[model samples]
Target: MPKKWFQNWFNSPYYHILYQQRNNAEAEFFIDNLCEYLKPSAEANLLDIACGRGRHSIYLNKKGYDITGIDLSIASIQYAKQFENSHLHFYVHDMRYLFYVNYFDIALNLFTSFGYFDTDYEHVKALKNFQKALKPDGLLVLDYFNSNKVLNMLCPQMIKTVSGVDFNIHKKIENDKIIKTIEFEDQNKPYIFKEEVKAFSMGDFKLFFEQSGFEISHCFGNYNLEEFDPANSDRLIFICKKAL
Candidate 1:
């Protein structure tokens, strides 16, 4: 059987090249804002799920928190491991599997990382795993795109040039999922990859959270931590706690 779209694309070197413009400044800004809002304890244990290259984990560890970064991409994990210390670690992990049980003080699934699976069952399973990874009353910070706004302002096609490579991109909504197709050539070879994410709304997440034993304590619209506006916000940021 062939590999899953994420398993193939995310593990490819081209994936890093295509998204190389995702700067550390943006990540730091968001994480700083988040820490300001959350005000977690200095000894807090954080689980950064889908932590690409340990950017957030490194920053959090620098801020006096114990952090573990996990991602399915082996290359990304290897790169992240170079930064590990006593309080910071990186591991290759799948979100759908349980990594720890009631261990972390905080769990984060950031950067629209929660909606790639083919079935709702798989998505819920991942959420359950996240729930299991946290302590009683632990916080889960989930950041996802505002699907409604994305669809309303959908751009059908575009071209992005990075590292002297031109990536042709197409996007569409089908079967309640947003599909992004990327095509590019490198070293005289062409490649195509697809990313399919469920267009989950607030209502959808409420159900997912309920099933996973979490309750949303706050919902922000963006990195600034403003109130959520379904039709206007660029991001859907949820601060949840394990349900009693």
Candidate 2:
């Protein structure tokens, strides 16, 4: 059977090449603010879900936390392992399955990592896994795009050239989901990829979390930790705590 879209696309070398500009600075800022706000113990166990290249995991580990990063892309995990130390680790994992039970003090699903599943149940299962992996008082920081603002700012088509590869990107909203079709050519070989993310609103997320044993403690609009504005915010950052 063919691999899933994310498995194939995210594992490809071109994926990293196209998104190479995502670096540590912005992530560091977010992490710094998040850590300050949550104030987890200095030796808290942190889990970074769908941790592409373990960037956030490595950063938190350097801040004296024990961090574990997991992603579905094996290649990304291998590269991320190069930065591992006694307090940092990376593994290839799927978010819908359970890993460590009641093991982490904090679980992070950053950079809009959720909402890739085709079925709504799958997304819930992923959140259940996140909840199951955390301790009783564990915190979950989910950084996702503001669906309302994104829908308002949707672009139909665009083109980007990265490392001499011209990527033709087209986006559309269908069936309550935002889909991006990516086509590119490299060295005379053609490539095609697709990314489909559910445009989940805050209400939708609240429902999901409530059903998955979590309660929303805070909602921020962006990396600066500002208040959320449904009409204008660029991102929807949710801070959730495991419910009793």
Q: Which lDDT values do the candidates have, in the order given?
A: 0.93, 0.93
How many residue pairs clash (N, CA or C atoms closer than 3 angstroms) in each of the candidate models, in the order given? 0, 0
Q: Please give each candidate's TM-score.
A: 0.98, 0.98
lDDT of each residue in 8-86, candidate 1, tens digit only = 8888888889988878888889999999998999888999999988888998898889999999999999999999999
In model 1, what are the clashing residue pairs, if there are any? none
Q: Which residue runs does candidate 2 get wrong by more than 4 Å? A: none
* Model 1 quality (TM-score): 0.98
Q: What would the per-residue lDDT of candidate 2 be over residues 86-165, giving only the tens digit for each residue?
A: 88999999998999999999999999998998888998899999999999999999999999999999999999998888
